[model samples]
Target: MTAAVTTEHREHYLALVGHGDEAAAVDYALGLAECGVSPRDLVLDLIGPTQRRIGDLWARDEWSVAQEHAATHVSEQVVAALAARHRPRPDRGVVVVACVDGEWHALPARLFAEVIRWDGWDVRFLGASVPGPHLVSYLHRHGPDVVAVSCSVPTRLTSAHRVIQAVQDVGVPVLAGGGGFGPGARWGTKLGADRVAADGRAALEVLRSWPLRAVAEVSPLRDSFVSDDEHVLVVKRGAQLVAVAMDRLADRFPAVHGYTAAQREATEYDLGQIVEFLCAGLFVDDVELFRAFVSWLCVVLASRRVPPETVDLVLDVYHDELFDFPRARAHLVAGRRQVPAGRQVAA
Candidate 1:
């Protein structure tokens, strides 16, 4: 059937990926393609959702990081196998798909590239974490009709904004995609994309109807940046803030002192992530962004058996440290509420 990969197919394919069965997964996908499931549907409906499920499983602690990575590798292989099997004519214009600088998640961008290729566009995938000047130079030489910037995490929005600015500067229409753009791609509009496509299908819709070479001739929205510049100031204190939180962590949460090397590393990462997410919310002037991230982080830490008080302590330390910056302090307070059974950190 030419229909989307049904639940039956998804479960079957996931089993292969879950077991790290790359050959079986690829063969199964190729079989589906040969049996009439279109390439776009195969990627969007099957591989895409499977990748997400892999993330969910990891966040829930059902899958180890190694397992998650293995499944992801298999999924990548399936995408490549499918691409090699179904070649599309690029009657449409050239499109370059790349992850924003500092964003290492390349699979989503690769998936999008393949989906658009099926739509008859010649897509040049730049893999993950493309730096600014490099991307701009490529735009100059390649002169693509559109450049799709992918950022999977909110922490990358600032990087995404820089890439969007660079692409627009080079006169290439910028299309912002992925979770970094926030709900309804509001942050994408804030960053000044010619258009925002949530996924590859929406990208095709916009690209197909996009006016003739709009990137070369028009700017869809004016460039945007933080008005108050508080985020700029707060970002500079990243290391100092992390050190203070870690320094004070043992006062309330003594368990951290006894952590093994891996646990300590993970704990440090979790602490750093809080600052990154807070800065991201500050960049966009949206407190809810930080709140959502805090909630998600709480769940993730809880799954790993981390006590909620550890978060409370960090937020308290950050709140006190960022006292001079009103917006940063407010975002910290908002994030603190999301921690389960959280206590206010006294200044």
Candidate 2:
């Protein structure tokens, strides 16, 4: 039987929020509405709080990618249904919401758009991965009153500055907000942004104030340590695109020289002097493998309760599979270090 949408629904909503369960969140919202919870209260108390919980869970690593997607989807549905139920307010102007190029995370933007819409402002959700030129064209054509740009990763911050320039060129005020701006309150200021909201609700409050002006002067792009080395492989994992430096791998793991020519030719591990490598899909690149291997070695060195079978398994499989593993292990043993037994080592 389906669970009744009662005060009990709040608990389920909380779970959906914490885990990013979209479908369950929608159902919870429906129940809350049936139980006579006003949309205004639902937005302020339920939806807002739920997003905060999702952020917390993400920080704690308690939620998976699937869970976060589910939560975001359900929250979107809730916003849509609520908007349909409420008559449009005539007072406020339109907002153009987007993420900067290379910044593909959009849940925060979507959530803020909904909250602003609920507060009587019209919103144009540009979704994720919007290019700067496209946004400039969009602003030129549509002429939204406010532009909201989000970037969760610090890596894409340089691209974000370009987005700000594009929007400002079209004479629209921009509201920049998200995880990236929280650490340094001066982040937006440094970027020459009009206003920086601490969060979604704070953004809404800033927009409502109306008197806040966006700076007109253009700013230079922020510094990026990410180099254009071809040996550098960039891989996207959710909102972050981690860059791996493979150029220094050989010096770090000189035992790689011990591999047979056949082994060297067959495995990607032998791409000598690799500057960058990506960690895309299921398989990890050589950089991540090395990092994981080192961390595993650390745990084995520290933990005493590891099983003998696990240690034997590591010696049998990894020692044979990796050309450098045997030499590395020998080095560790020579240092009088004891390795722990384990099935899978944490990285």
Candidate 3:
């Protein structure tokens, strides 16, 4: 029987995890298990939200990378504890859970594996960034009923598409999940996945209702975006783009000019991500892909007390640099519009 996950219980678990007390967090989870809180709810309700909060805290600068890593480590321990307590039923079908290549966020995929195992599926949880060829080799050897791919970062969508196709080539139906797939798994369908789940619970429901003899579709790789040479140009010039943007940033924002080594490196990383996402968006031929990232970038910068206009300035620099590339120019312009105007740093 599933126990009730009251707000009080949730808060207690979150507090323990946030404090980086792995033993305390595990004990708390075990106590809930003793009280009949189902393993599924334990993962989805308590651990899931706590991990998300950790990410949010990091984005807002409320937590350091070390703190975030420590908290995530605790969550993983909690999941292991739950897994030990719940034994799988042998009669259920086998399912393989993994993250797409280049996606280092493994907790969500781990949570899904635990939830599905609790629901009686024999889950093989391949943690973190399984390459396409390796995943295909596993499929040929194990022959699971379904393969669930988890991707958290939008920038890895291109990799996700490759993994999806590779799995289908081996005749395994693929279930795509996570934020990288876009709202409602719109990108998943475009990538030729058999199904898309919003979360673990939803994934379970979809699996339950899935046809027994579903044949994975073999679709040709979509090539409409390949003809756009602008993506290639931006990728080839990425380093130059970052360097020029940094030079222009120093002129526009005094804070950037006086940044410490660590701060300068962080800013450089941020600029690199912008270029990468732009190229990824171009590869997918979806402007919203880049636009959504810009919106999130604005929030992250605002949280760090930096002017959101920094994104606009970067985009402006790109516009001038890529002026001859029509598609790249248009996408940069669209991204610039998504960033709301904020206080400009005095130069």
Candidate 4:
């Protein structure tokens, strides 16, 4: 294809996203394939940007659940049709895409398959929620050049880690991706995975030239806004949580002490453990008091310069006590007094 034709085809793909026209996107991808456009080019030039836009639309609330589902279905059809025309290349190395046991989000994995296919790889996509035994059996059977796992929820991390360990046991390298591996996202390294890709394009680039032999120098997964996990802090409001790594939370809580250390241990359930301890001082089942206590932990104990051992002591004391609303409310009030009156509440 001429440069102009390729560019025009790519633009058509982008236009589909701009208009939220999944059908148009499908037609464009098919048109590129029929016109003898390289699958790699189609993926690198078209599908990557298109999927990013789709994610952005969802993020911005510009696309409803139905619309997002429709878009994903359309993209899947397009990739399936294209794959039917091109068989996996023998020399491009083996790749398998699977979702962790509990994550139903397969669009990311689908887009990635299209990407590796475009890169001339031999890809076997296991779709959403393939169990650990199946994954192990498949890895033992195929011994792919790389294994790419998608996990979209933090709740699924335990399962995802299990999958990674299972795959690694067979000597397969695993690359962990998806929204779950965000800034301050924990357990990626502890799960013993090889690498984590922050975005789709970055993932494709890394896998293409990745070494067959493992690189002994393992490092933390880099995030969009933060590269270092030690600097990220996670804030939990009861069951809801948000994580900010790389000193971003520091700017948000200027008056809070020990922000650095708090950032270091801010993993999922870690805050919950802290909350349980702090709640001991408060009344149980009191939502308002609990929220206030969480806020206090974030701003006071978490923000200030409390020693890690001291903070651990506080959490140890309150890990499990009956609801004491009046006492908890009093502690909340005292905590609030330490901060400026008009600060924003923690999530």
Candidate 5:
């Protein structure tokens, strides 16, 4: 009976948010709490998985940005209602949660914060993309037992690395969590976090075992890059590469030449995203990162009626332009391989 109810609730909750019915969703979550659903389960089980599905819906092109945003906002409201209803006293040590710089997805961090708060730790959630320096200052002022850094998008891994290093430098142990850290969050260890968790529930287990770990005992950041300068050079030259790709795209597509200002801007943004993802893949020394991004980009573009072959051309131009950067070229090759063989190289 409990399993049946859980399934029904999951389906109903997803439907509520999908339609942007925030008040109803919040009511439903709170009603579950009233009906003996543990607050922790409400967050980690219901809101968290639903939020991820919202992301997946957007990724699969089944939902537009507006719909995704609406669904996400509803989830946030549900989380808040639950948290407000069950504010456990902070018996455990204080812990701060923050999204890494440039990671605007704060819901994951918020989910962790609410869960830990219910578990009795005082959670200070620094919402949405706190800069490293500012975060360090917050740590100094508050002196939490640890800080959990969240990064959802892989492109923000460089910023995550910097923030982890910066937080550890200031005598605080860092707990790295979020999707950006790659599978199993192996990249989090590479970035020098004291501990890593793949999600809020996993983070809870990590904190329970070692909530007050000292700074000096944490693992130092590993040197993951083969050519450290390649990622940096890609970022530094990103604008130039985008401009070059744009010009070349106009030549190949011809349609780009007739693009309106909005169209041109959007194209530039897409090209820039390609470079950004490439830089991230290089930063983490993972070809799979670039390949994954190319595959997803293909789906996104295809859903929007843009030719996936455009990504192929962009990769080719990037490969040619980054000829001097061996690592960059190699990752681009991986990304190129992800593009469906829509057209042959333009000789």
Candidate 6:
């Protein structure tokens, strides 16, 4: 049965976890569970929101990385405590939950696994970043009803396609989730996944209705589609791209020019993400994948008091560097469109 989660209850859990009070947070969640609040609500309502808030706090500079990591640890403890008290009914069929290769954000996948287990499905939670070969071997051995693939970052979409194809080759259907799959599961469908779930509840609904079938020969999408030499070329030159962009940004923007070693490294990391997401967008043949990331990057830069035009400068640098690659140039053009024209640095 689904339990009601009051706003007060939600805020209470957030306060406990945010303060690094893992014991109190775990106790508070367990208390709610004992009161009959569904484990699903505990995950989706309390812990899930808290995790997002942690990221928001860090992005706004209100919380340090240490604080974010500590808060995440607290949330993990709460989930662990909840899983210990609740036992699966075992009447529902088996499901395997795992993060795609190269995806380290395992909390969402962990929460989804526990919620599915509480909903009566037998779950084998394979933690984070399960390699393709190992995952296929596990599926062959256990043969679960469905596989839930979780991805949190857009950069991992290429790896996700590989995982989706690998699981499908063994005749197992995949339900892709996480922000990495892109808004509305756009990339998931393009990657040829059987289904996509926006959240834990939606994942459960899809799993319930999924059709079972025998293992058959499922052809891989990568082979059928035209070769993605553009993606490969961009990825192969990722380091050079970041290096050149970093040097150019420092020359073009005073803020970047005066950055400390740590700040320069951060700038380098951002440039690297731009290149990676660009490649990922190319891989999926979708402009929105790169566009969405640029939009979000603008917001993050604004939060840090950096001019969003810095993103424009980086895009311009890439345009000059990759002029030979028309497809890459086109994706960069789409990304630059998302940023506003005026350059106003936050003070």
**TM-score between candidate 1 and the true structure:** 0.95
- Candidate 5, position 330, lDDT: 85
Q: Which candidate is the best by lDDT?
A: 1
Candidate 4's residue-wise lDDT over 124-227, tens digit each?
Answer: 89999999998989888877877898887554665776788777767778888876554322345445568777666777777876884664434343222112
After superposing candidate 4 on the true structure, give the runs of residues whose Cα lies further than 4 Å from its correct spot.
1-24, 33-37, 183-190, 213-342, 345-347
The estimated TM-scores of all candidates read: 0.95, 0.58, 0.91, 0.56, 0.94, 0.91
Alpha-carbon runs more than 4 Å astray in model 3: 216-229, 254-260, 342-347
What stretches of model 6 exceed 4 Å from their correct place? 1-3, 214-227, 254-260, 342-347
Model 1 clash pairs are none
Cα RMSD to the true fold for all candidates: 1.9, 11.2, 3.3, 13.3, 2.4, 3.5
The lDDT per prediction is 0.86, 0.56, 0.84, 0.58, 0.85, 0.83
Q: Which 10 residues in a row give candidate 4 its minimum summed lDDT?
A: 225-234
- 315 Cα displacement, candidate 6 (Å): 0.8
Candidate 3, residues 60-119, lDDT tens digits: the string is: 888888989988999999999989978877567888999999999999999999898888
- Model 1 residue 145 CA deviation (Å) reads 0.8
Q: 1-347, model 6: which lDDT tens digit per residue?
A: 55678889878877887799988998898888888888889899888987887888787778888988988988998899888888867788888999999899899999999988888889999989999999999999999988889999878887888898899888788888998887776677678777788888888887776664533423244335444689999899899999898788777766777789998887788888899999988888888888888887887788888887788888888888887888888888888888878332211
User: Lowest-lDDT window of 10 residues in candidate 6?
Assistant: 214-223
Against the true structure, whose TM-score is highest?
1
The TM-score obtained by model 2 is 0.58
Full-model lDDT, candidate 2 = 0.56
What would the TM-score be for candidate 5 when compared with the true structure? 0.94
